[model samples]
Target: MNASTFTTRFRAAMMPTVPSPLAMLSHGKGARVWDVEGTEYLDFLGGIAVNALGHAHPVFTRAVSAQAERLAHISNYFASEPELALAERLTRLTGGDAVYFTNSGTEAIEAAVKLARRTGRPRILSLTGSFHGRTMGALSLTGKPVLQDPFRPLLPGVEQIAPTIAALEKALADDVAALVVEPIQGEAGVVDLPDGYLAAARELTSRHGALLILDEIQTGIGRTGDWFVYQAEGVLPPGAAPDAVALAKGLGGGFPIGALVGFGAAAQLLQPGQHGSTYGGNPLATAVAGAVLAEIEDAGLVANAALRGAELRAAIAGMASPLVAELSGRGLLIGVVLTRPVAKEIVAAAQERGLIVNAAAESRVRLAPPLIIGDAEVAEFTEKFAAALAAVAASTPTGATA
Candidate 1:
């Protein structure tokens, strides 16, 4: 269907909560998509960082195709082999005891949050500027109130703490259940907690009888230089791993999958029937996720993300354009914060020049190209991005706030 037709159908058939422009879609394939009019552009956004191997990878296409042919879904009434296999892979990757799959990252967070609260505690703490899914339970743990205000009286007993030992200590209480934080805050313009931040959080949470919940949905499964950023950071802090980790985004590659993993005693916290989902642990999604995991390992996409991401950051930082004030993030998730709020305009401009990027916030642009993106794509984006920024600069004052 054309973008306009789908857009019209969306207006008629779907909820009106999300913005209109976000509803438009046409077609997608590895790092590229075409609008309704058949306009082609590089897909650096990667379905908001969901495209692990990029669009239309033969393996992804074949995996989904084979699964659909074998069995599209089984309603979670029976155990699925593909799902179990995927779970085993995840458990191995996580170095954890048990795992529960979910339809999306928010649901994964919901499972984690509920498991934390089931401990008979009344309080849980998450960091500010974190974006968990929009479900009521997931939304409850989310720190952004603007997104949650419309649906009031959220899952209560949530307290937000800054990224500091002192703040975490102050928020910890006798009745606290868990503390949730993103290794690198993705939605908040890709802001990262400073070094040793996670290590310290683990220590304090342990000291206070609270569970440490690390949201790696955006940063896990080889999106960052590591399979799980917390795993890499765990060694830095010289301590044990986090109690629970929520992973999604790149886990399923382009398929819909998310996981909530718990280690040791925390793994036993989520007993059978305590939580479940219809579409979760299906053969299709898990098989695709397993394929993605295999690809990441076989192709070394994680190391690719690491080295290529460094090259990208260096290129962005090296650009003499006065618009670029700073650069941050690891792996393929790079954030280019401009001096002004011209992020949206820059993204639009990049698209016009045959590139795709995202304006994460008003002031920053987040580029999450597929992990398999190569030097060719990166080089093209580098030149085109410079041209786009120069175009913006030429049209406006040099030091004008973006």
Candidate 2:
């Protein structure tokens, strides 16, 4: 079926808040996908950074099937090997001592909020342009007014500060329970927080006894050239480790999973019965996460992510198109800034050329391809991206930039 037909059917079947379905995706392999009508496209969005190992990796599929055959899920009252192993591994990776599993990124944020509140402090601080999640508690922490305005009277005591050291230091108060910041603002047009600002936040939070929470839902799981974005030396400054970290997106390698890792004293905040999820650490999901981690280690995708990410950025920069103003973000998560507010036009043009990209803002085009993307895909993407730019420039008004 065509996209229009699928959109019509989907609109009738699903809730109205969801935007129109882009396409009736039939199947995907590696870094490419096909729509229901069999039209092919290179998938740069990577399921919005959730496909860590890309589509249908053999190890991932095998692990899921094997775990399904043995067992699927049990209540939080019961313990499972996969769940335990995955939690242990994640904690080790993040320099944390404890973990709480959830079904998605938003749930992870919600759990983190509750953990922060347990400190008895009533206020939480987040950076402006932050996108934690859509749930009421997570929405309360999000800095975007458009998302929070509709959900008015959100959980109280959450305030936003700028992504700068001065703003953070000025806004911090004794009543603050935690300061949540994304190392790289993915939804806010791939904006990266200054390293010194992060360092200042750590020092100040330490002094004020407020927990530091890093939201790595988009930048984690090797998406940003590191196991976790904070793992990269110099990203968070010396002696700077967040008290709590929320993770999801690519953690399960496509299976639904998320985790909140608490370090030091914050680890003991959430005791038994304080928080839980029905499918948080289900055997199936945890098994897939374990396999995803194993695959990343064995195949050296983390290093590959670093290498390819640099190459992608350099190539785009070398294009030297006047319409291409700049590029933001690291690793597979990138944003191409246009000289004007032509991101929507560029995205449509790229789609017409069988390349999938997202318009993160009016002038920002975001690309979050799979970590496994390589030279051939990069070359093809660059060529198509240039073509998309040419298409835009040709049709744009003579006085305006594409």
Candidate 3:
């Protein structure tokens, strides 16, 4: 069956919340993917920033293949070498004392919230416009009222404040178990937090004895030009670090793996029976994650993400279209703000031209291209994106121009 036929049937059987299928993807290579009909498209979305090495990198393939042949699944009761090695590597990368692996981003957040609860402080603080996860516990910390209000009476004791030093200080004056913030807000249109804001969070959380949890699910693992966006010098005050971090999207490079990393005293909160995951760190997932990390390090993809991201952002902004108002975010995670509410139109036009983009909001188009994207890919995307913007402008009705 083709995409339309399967999509119709699938939607009938599955939840209605899933977006209409863009295409029945069949295979991929490098930074490109093909649908069942053999149409190729540049994968600018990168599975929503999950594919770190891009599609089908040799190293990723070899490592996953070898590990699959040996061992793929084992209960948490029996630890494997790959799982231990992966956890150790992640903790070292984040300067955390220990880690608890899970199966997805939301799971990582749940584990982190649980760790916060272990503090017995009775309250958690988050920033306005934050997007932690959709699970009940995480939904409590998510600041978007629309997403939270629908499921009212959410986990209580979760408060949200404006993402500023003054607001943070005011909130911290009260008893709190943890203060969670994303180094860069992804779902809220790739909003980058100010560096001093993060430093302030570290200082205040420390002062209040509240754990500082940086939700790096979208910005971690070289997506933001660094191993972790929090690692950017000057982003954190001297001798300061987050008490915990939630990681997932890019950690496994398309494999399903997530982690909750706890630093210093925060590491000792969880006991053996307090929390667990059945398939959280199975051998296959950890092996793939380990390979993903190795490829990122060996290929210098981190530096490449930085250089290419700057180039792409500059090129897009340089277009100077009246419809293109501005750009936000860093590295491969970018948000294009438009003068009009035509982001959905732009996304459709880009897809028609064999490019994938995301409409993060009515006027914001988000691009989280693979970290392995290069100069040629960036140039091609810029050309197509400009064309998409022009298409949207031409289709606009009179008096709708902004």
Candidate 4:
């Protein structure tokens, strides 16, 4: 069907949380997708940075199919080998002592919040412009009030702090149980943390006896060249780490899954019956995640992401298109800020030319292509992007800064 029909049918019944169009995905492979109209587009969005190994990856297909045949789910009342294996892998890779799986990123954040509050502290600190999730609890931590205005009186004691030392000192206190911060604020048009920000936040929270919860929902799972941006940025000390980490988006290679990892002292915070899920770590999702992680190593996808990421960013920046105001982000997660507010036009133009990109903000065009994107695709997208920017510049209102 077309965008109009899809929107008309779904928007009426669905909760209007996200302004999503009903352009149904017919199929996807590698870094591209075909809509129901059979129109193919280069998928730079990558399912909002969730398709880590790209669409329909062989490893993901095989692992999920094979696990489905053996067993689907048996709940937490019983144990599954794949689930245990996935947990061990995450703990080993992340150095977290334990993990709690959820069905999506919002749920993972909820678990982390619970872990922080389990210590009897009630306050939480989060950064401005950060997009945590739409859940009521997570929504309280999100800085954007647009998402929270309709659902007022969110969880009490949630504080939104300006990304400044002065603000942290003023707002957070010993009674604060957690400080959640995104390594790179993706939905804030791919904003990166200032140098020494995360480290100082970690220290301040520790001093106050509050847990430092790193929200890696977007920047984890090899999206930032490294497994997690915190590792590459050197935020964690030799022995110290975040009390807990929330992960999702790219963890399962498009197979839905999220994780809350509690490390060291934080591990025992969530005791039995404190938190559980029916399909969080079921065989299919864990098997897929485990397979994707293994395949990323075997196929050298992580290294490829580093190399290709650099190349892609350089190409986007080098164009020096008049409309492009700035280029930001690490690894495959890059954002191009425009001189004017024509993000909708740019996105629509790119779509018409069989390219897919996302308008993250009024003047920011974010590019989160698949990890397996080749040089040819990069070149193709760059050319189309330049043209799209030119068109936006020519037709839109005159320049104003991003």
Tell me the lDDT of model 4 at 252: 91
Worst 10 residues of 2 by lDDT: 393-402
- Which pairs of residues have clashing backbones in candidate 3? none
TM-score of each: 0.95, 0.98, 0.97, 0.96
Q: Write the per-residue lDDT of candidate 4 for residues 37-145, one digit (tens) a residue.
A: 8988889999999998888988888998899999988887888898899999999878889999999999999998888889898788899999999898899999998
Candidate 1 segments exceeding 4 Å error: 1-13, 22-25, 233-236, 398-402
Using alpha carbons, what is the TM-score of model 3? 0.97
Give the least accurate 10-residue stretch of model 1, judged by summed lDDT: 230-239
Clashing residue pairs, candidate 1?
30-55, 340-402, 341-402, 342-402
What's the lDDT for residue 59 in model 1?
84
In angstroms, the error of model 4 at 163 is: 1.3
Candidate 3 regions exceeding 4 Å error are 397-402
Q: For residues 1-402, what per-residue lDDT tens digits would candidate 1 score against the true structure?
A: 666778788789889877566325578877778777777888888988889898899889889889889977888788888988888988898888788989889889999998898778999898878888889988887778888899998887887777676787687876889998888888988887877778778777788888988898988888778888877745336648888899888988878889999887899887678888999888889988888899889999989999989988888877888889888888888888888888888887887798888888988899888999888888888998998888876776656675
